[model samples]
Target: MVDALLDIAGLRAGYESTTVLRDIDLRVEEGQLSVVIGPNGHGKTTLLRAISGLVTSSAGRITFAGQDITRMRPEAISARGLVHIPQGDALFPDMTVLENLTLGAFLRRGGRAERSQQLAVVYDIFPRLAERSSQRARTLSGGERRMLALGRGLMADARMLMIDEPSLGLAPVLVDEVYRQIARIAESGMTILLVEENFSRVRDLADRLTLIENGEVRASGTVQEVLADPAVAATYLGIES
Candidate 1:
C-alpha cells in the first residue's frame, strides 16, 4: 500500500491471555474517512487501542506512513502523527480547556510557534473552545466536551486521527453538530478511522465502511458495498434481508 496512511495485517491483540482482536487486517488510505462499526464488546475499541499502541499486539504488523510501528510506544507512535482520542472524555476534567488543548501538543518536537499555529487551527474549527478557553473541561456540556476533545486532537497536529465514539452520549441536536464538525474535519484533509455506533449518522460521511465482529473483519468496502450485504443487515442491524 504505497499511499496508505495506516495498514494492519495479521493483527492479534489481547489482555492477559484473553484475546480481543484476532488476525485482523485493515487499511486506511491517505485522506479517507474510514469507519469501523459493530456491536458492543466486539473488539472495536481494542482495534483502535492496538493501532494507537495502548494495547500491544502479540503478532502482527502495523505500518504508518510506510514505517513499521508494531512495537512503538504510544507516545512515539503519536509523535509520528497518529493520534488516538479514546472513547469518552479522556481529558483532565479539572483542567481548563486551554490547558487540555495545550497538553496535546506536548509530544511534538516543535516549539511554541508550531504549537500556536496548531491551536489556531483548532480554535478555528471549534470556535466554542476559544470562547470557553478558561472554563474547566468538566463544566462543558456533552457536545461541548466532545468538541474540546476533538479540538485537542487537532492541537496535536494529527495526520491520522483514530477516534472512538465521537457521539457516544449526546442529544439529537448535539449529535448532528458533532457529526457536522467531523465531516468538516475530513473535508479539511485528515485521514480518520472512526469507530462509531451511530451508523446512520456516519453512513453518508464515510468513504469506506468496515464491519468488525468477534475480533475479525467480517465485511469491508465502500459504504454501499458493505451496507448492501444481507449478512451485515441480519447480523449487525437485526434486519432480515
Candidate 2:
C-alpha cells in the first residue's frame, strides 16, 4: 500500500479577525514534488504556515505520516520530520552558518556523531554552506541565505518539506539553480510541497499543482490540468491569456 506523507483536509486558518485560509483540502503523497501557485495574497504562505503549526488552524484535520497533528505546536510538528522553510530567508542574521544548522538538530536526542553525519549530508547538497561554515548568515548573499535555510531543514532528515517562494529575490540564473536544487531534493525521494509565485518555473517543475484564491482552493490537479483551464488562470492565478 502507498502511504500518504502529508494529508490536509478541510483545513482553515488565519490571523486575528482576518480569515486567511478557508476549507483547503490538499494532499502530497510520498516521493512527489507538488507545487502550489496562485495570485498575490491567495493564502499560499498561510497554508504552509498552517502546516508547520506557525499559524493556527481554525478548522479541519492535518495528518503527517498518518498521525493527527492538527493542533500540535510548531516544535512538535517539526520534531515529527515535517519541516517548513518560509519565504524570507528566515535565518538569524548574526548567527554563524554552523550555529544555524546546529539549531535544526536541537530536537534530536543524538550526539555529535549523528549531528556530524547530518551536517556532512547537508554540506554535500550545498557546498557554499560548507565554505562559509563559520561566517555570519547576514554576510552571505540572498541566494546563499536561501540555500542555508533549506540545508538547515534537511538536517532534520525531514520526511516532507513545505517551502515558500524559493525564487522570491533571486536572479534568473539563481532561480534556475534553486529549482535544480529543489528537483535534486525530490529526486532523492523526499516529498515537497512548494508554494511559489514563479508560475513559469512551477509549471515546469511541478508534477501536481493546487491553485488557491481568496483563502480557498479553486483548482487542484496536474500542472497541465490546472494551467489549461482559462477560469483557473484568470481568477486564481491572475494569469491573462
Candidate 3:
C-alpha cells in the first residue's frame, strides 16, 4: 500500500458564521505530488488554511504521518514539518531576501551548519535568490518574489509542503518557470500538496488529482482517472464524456 503522508476525512471548516468546506476527503501520498484544482471561491485556499491550522475545522479530522493533528496549534503543526506556503507569496516586504529566507528555519531544530546546508540547497534550487540575497523582498519582480517564497519554504525542510496556488498572478512565461521549479522539487522526492486554480497548470505535474467544487470534493483519483470522469468532463472541461 502507498503511504499517505497527509490525509483528511469528512473535514468541515469556515470563517465565523460561513461554512466554506464540507465533508472534504483527500489524501497525499509520501514523495508524490498531489494537485487540488478548483475555481476561485470554491474553498481551495480554505482547504489549505484549514489543513495548516490557520482555520479551525468545524468537524472531521486531519492526519499527518499517522498522527491526529486536528486540534494541533498551527505553529506546532508547522514544527512537525508540514509547511504551508500561502498564496500571495507572504514574504517580509522590508526584509532582505536572505533575511526572509533565514526566518523560515525559525522552528527548525538544528545548528548553524545544518541550517547553512539547507540554505545552500535552496540556493541551488533557486539561484536567483542567492543573487538577490541582499535586496529587499518588496523590490523583486513577481516571479522572483515567488521564487523567494518557495526557497523560504524549502528552508523549513518540510516533510510535506502544502503550496497554495503557486501560479497565481503571473505571466504565462513566468508561470511556466515556476511550474518547472515545482517539477524539479518533486523530482527530488519531496512530498507536495499543491493547489491550482487552473487545471492546465498542474495537469502534467500531478501524480494524483482531486477536483474541488463549491468546497466539496467532486472527484479524485490518478490524473487520468479523474480527468476521464464524466462529471468532471462536463462541469470542468466543458465537454461531455
Candidate 4:
C-alpha cells in the first residue's frame, strides 16, 4: 500500500439491513490500475458504490489522498478528486455528448481557460467523443457511451477513478477498445480502481486485484497469484471453489 492514494480499512456497508461489503481492505497506489473481478452477485458494484458514498457505510475508514472520507457526501468526495463512474451508461440521454462531458467539470473551480484545457485533453483521449460532440448521448452506440462516461470522469480531474464494468455490454472488439482507453487513462498518471466481470480484460490491465464474493474479500494479490488459486478464483468467479 505504499504510495497509496485511496485506502480502505475494515470497510463494511450495504443497503438497509442487507450487508454487502464486509471487512474490505483495498489500496490503489498512485498511477496504478487496481481491478476487482468477480462473477455476478459478488458485490463488485456495491463495493464501488461504497467507495463513492452512494451507499452508507456501517463501519470502517476510507482515506483518499491522506484524508478521511468515510462519511462524506458524493459531491464532496468527487470534489476532493475521487470520481466514480457507476455501471451502465449513466449519461444524460437527452443531452449531447459534449454537453455531458462538459458537465463533469461543473463542480470544478476552474475558469474558462482551465475548462478549455481539460476539454482538449478529453478530446485527445477519445477523438470519437470530439467527433460526436454535437450528438445526443442517447444516440451514441454502447461503446461510444462508455467513452463519454470515461471522458466525463477525466474532466473531473480525479486523482483516483473508480470505474465499474467498462465492458459490460460491448462486442469483443469494442470491449477491447474500451479497456485500451481505460489503460491509456491510467497511463496519464491517475490511479484507477475498476470492477469488471471480463476476467481476461482484468488480467491484462490490472496492476493488482481483489476478489470479493458474498460481500467479503476472498483474495487479494497480483494477477498470477490470485488467478492460480483454484479456490480463490472459483470462490469469486463462481466456478468451483
How accurate locally, in lDDT, is each candidate?
0.90, 0.87, 0.92, 0.88
lDDT of 1 at 92: 94
Better of 2 and 3 by lDDT: 3
* Local accuracy of candidate 3 as per-residue lDDT tens digits, 115-197: 99999999999988899999999999999999999989999959989999988899999999999999999999999999997
> lDDT: which candidate is best?
3
TM-score of each: 0.95, 0.93, 0.97, 0.94
RMSD of each: 1.4, 1.9, 1.2, 1.9
Candidate 4 local lDDT, 87-156, one digit each (tens): 8789999999988988999887779899889999999989999999999999999999999999999899
State the number of backbone clashes in model 4.
0
Deviation (Å) of 233 in candidate 1: 2.9
lDDT of 1 by residue, 3-114 (tens): 6889999999989889999899898999999999998899999999999898989998999999999999999999999999988888999999999999988887678999
lDDT (Cα, tens digit) per residue for candidate 2, span 14-106: 998898999989888888899988887879999999898898898999999999999999989988889999887888899999999998788
Quality of model 2 by C-alpha lDDT: 0.87
Tell me, by TM-score, which candidate is best: 3
Where's the lowest-lDDT run of ten residues in candidate 4? 232-241
Worst 10 residues of 2 by lDDT: 231-240
Pick the winner on lDDT between candidates 1 and 2.
1
Candidate 2 deviant stretches above 4 angstroms: 234-241
Q: What count of clashes does model 2 give?
A: 0
